[model samples]
Target: MPGHAGERLILTGPLRLVPGTTEQILSRLADLGRTVSTEDGVTDGLSVLALSVDDVVLCLPTVIMDGRPRRWPSATVDRRIDLTSYAFAEPDLISAYAPELIEHLNVGHADQMRQLARHARPAETEGDIAGVQVSGLDRYGLDLWRVDSAGAEQVRVAFRQPLVEPRSLGRELRRLLDQSANTSE
Candidate 1:
């Protein structure tokens, strides 16, 4: 997952050390427009260097066995690094690496979600399941805000079948509303 700065670049598993000095590796990363930084840490039985650039963080891992750098069998590097805090702040960088994320965060999805919210029906229950408001919607599912006496509860409902078209979403909403109505009765 070596995408742009804003997009997620997920690297999993062990990484084989490149045939070069530490300085050389760092230089290579710099050439790729990354601001390289080193931390004294071990990740997945390997010496890890934290690389940061344009608000993106990546791990440069080296294989170390028996207190020495050893050659790995495979060239692939895999390690779990949590980058939830990192964000793509630059639009140009995001477009270069992960254009799909840009598309997802676009106005079109917001508009669709707005439309879905307008069409959402009230729940028939008198308890916590008060009014059913479609708060957010994506290709996968819809997020619902179940307004109640206590507070607004968030509920996400994934479609049982993949919605191939926009019209299908309306049908699914109707079905969910009907099911809720029946359950309340």
Candidate 2:
């Protein structure tokens, strides 16, 4: 069950307004290699920044908290994705990017309502606001979420679940790289 777990972690929490907290987070994220290629660039939180941040290129878990869950934790909002997801992706960026799996949930489906809260894939978000389609290779693209600032906050982080396992992707990538190198020589 461990290997088959849906996703691994849900890294979403409000940035407590403390001294230097923002700079610390931004500085650390900045060190994570931002620019990967001419076509791919990563950034801190906006699309027009010029510099880009590369997706961690990690295989992990994803957590999704539906805004319209049959029950409300405190407020009454329907057809909306709650704090964690938005707080994770917006103020971020808006563009078409190739998505990578960052956070994941141990499982994705459930049998009961309460079980859903316990079971389901955890969605981890960071860096930017984007969308991810769980299955399919070359699966489409990353769509940036539009945040209009309504006294609240929002974020968009896209985590795509690859059709193949991470191990297999490694092998295939290695094979391709090797082939390319051989041809170059």
**Which runs in model 1 stand beyond 4 Å of their true positions?**
1-132
Candidates in order, TM-scores: namely 0.31, 0.17
- In the range 1-185, model 1's lDDT, one tens digit per residue, is 44332233553344444556656765776788965443854222323354343333343344566896544344435444444644423233323323443245233444433333333434423443345545455556767665556667676677667565556656775675566557546
- Top candidate on lDDT is 1
Q: Candidate 1 at 18: error in angstroms?
A: 43
lDDT of 1 at 139: 58
In candidate 2, position 114 carries an lDDT of: 18
Q: Which is the leading candidate under TM-score? A: 1
Quantify how close model 2 is to the true structure by its C-alpha RMSD in Å: 20.7
lDDT of 2: 0.30
Candidate 2 backbone clash number = 32
